[model samples]
Target: MTRRQAITATATLGLALLLLAMGAAARPLLVDEHPLSRPVLNPTEIGFAQDMLAHHSQALIMTARLDQTADPTVVALADRIEATQREEIGELKGWLRMAGASTVNNAPMQWMHPNNSVTDHHHHAATPSETADGGPAMPGMATQTELDALSAARGTDAARSFLHMMTRHHYGGIQMAQAANNLLTDGIVKQTARDMMTNQTQEAALMEIMLNSLTTAR
Candidate 1:
């Protein structure tokens, strides 16, 4: 309308734009730009991944040692177990790598008991074969002697030994997975743990039934 009025309106718009720009500048930047914002695994997640990797590795070893002449059902179960564990191992390793964590853990099973609190019945004093981090041997892990026995056995004996050992192994894995699932609030790792618990629990039950049938057939 008037020149003075137009000038006043223009100044007010400029001031509003300046305030908006300042507000945007004051906001926090994206976390991707910060070093601390990089993906970090909590102690529980790191421990689960590392220990489970070791556990799954042993399962592979057991499957590799299985006698080819064993029962077809037993052989098939071993193959399935190997395949599942191998895929999970890859995922665990990927997560660990993304977090810049070591794939191998010297101190195992610490995640189950934070702050020296141990209430699990499965916890046992460390044996000479598996003493790590001043803690007990991981539950359900076969001793070297047992593994050697399984390696030496053949045919039905091999299947029986494998079924027994793997059943126990699955039990241990279920325990660890359950613990991880409980400890983690919510994340990919937690979901992975829950899946492991379900899968391993079912496997263990099947193994038990197989073992019973094998024994009865003998």
Candidate 2:
């Protein structure tokens, strides 16, 4: 089997017991050459940076619920997620503040393939999605159905829903982050994107593990 297959199998079989003992403490290795580094921030970067902060802020609000009522295991995970995302929100805001940009731009953009990357070269800070084919797509965010379900859950139920929806949430998030990585030149934004990729990827893996535990227990 391929290395990925091997890792998947290992993750499926043994990762659970290890997680309870090890918890979610994996820190990403910072590679020297940033794949997302750029020099000049673009509209795409501004939109991505601000939108992601808003998105993650919602996650923080959701995860805080877990901290209040979930099992200890889930509460542990929620705490980690909340801490990391809070720090990221601060970092993204700092970038906007430094750029003298308002995070409140109403420009609607979607996350698109690299072919349609939007750079904030104009420094409009208006957001890329506001422009359409003029920029990337940033829609498909979680809806009220998902949020209500999250609010209604308790114990492992809450844990499972949080992880499942959050996996999808982080999937979109990674797309936005990748766009920012490609579209911006600001060192801090680039660093923040890299950190998001590293940390969220690891958290997603752990969430999947916890999710499987929920299934098996059922």
Candidate 3:
């Protein structure tokens, strides 16, 4: 081949190699390092965090009243509930914040039944619980009257009331956690929800056993 032909062919090959290298380097920047990239979470995850926070808050309130009971078993159970739930609440809040989600939501449980904008009468599905003044209600929450009653009870009565209320509360919590397990894409959030469901289910069973004991004694 002529020197000129050899030089031109070498130049063409070098330019092609450089172009390929540039594209290779730019590929990741275009796909992974885009400035608009943000963590994606669905509505179900957001609702779970928001609803569970409210649910755990009520659990804390109930557990705080454990001092009114003379039962050591009851008090110990309450202490465990308070401590575990507080930590879980923190985790939920952290996950929500990291995902750029707000714990504050205008409509509660919408993700549980996304299709049903109105309140429906299904066991698994939930509609938003609204008050006369339009305040949202947490599922399985005790009324103020019930709270006052629980506060006034002593001995076995307090123990029994707490067990009854808490068991119901945990059922609601398990439902929410199960929904989260099904919905959330994030591994941390999904695993957290699974742990919650398992823990709360066992706790609820224990509470029922204790409640039955109290009943049998009377």
Best by TM-score: 1
Per-model CA lDDT versus the true structure: 0.85, 0.68, 0.79
lDDT string, candidate 2, 87-149, tens digits: 888877887786678875464343323343454333323433335333323432455556677
Q: Is candidate 1 or candidate 2 better by TM-score?
A: 1
Clashes (backbone N, CA, C under 3 Å), per candidate, total: 0, 16, 0
TM-score (C-alpha, index-matched) for candidate 2? 0.65
Ranking by TM-score: 1, 3, 2
Q: Which lDDT tens digits does candidate 1 get at residues 71-129?
A: 99999999999999999999999989988899987667778787664443345553323
The ten-residue window of minimal lDDT in model 3 covers: 124-133
lDDT of 3: 0.79
Q: Give the Cα error of residue 66 in candidate 1, in Å.
A: 0.5
Which candidate achieves the best lDDT against the true structure? 1
Clashing pairs for model 1 are none
Per-residue alpha-carbon lDDT of candidate 3 for residues 104-142, written as tens digits (9 for 90 to 100): 766677777677763652543242233233334556666
Model 1: ten consecutive residues of lowest lDDT: 127-136
- In model 3, the Cα lDDT at residue 29 comes to 75
Ranking by lDDT: 1, 3, 2
User: What TM-score does each of the candidates earn?
Assistant: 0.79, 0.65, 0.77
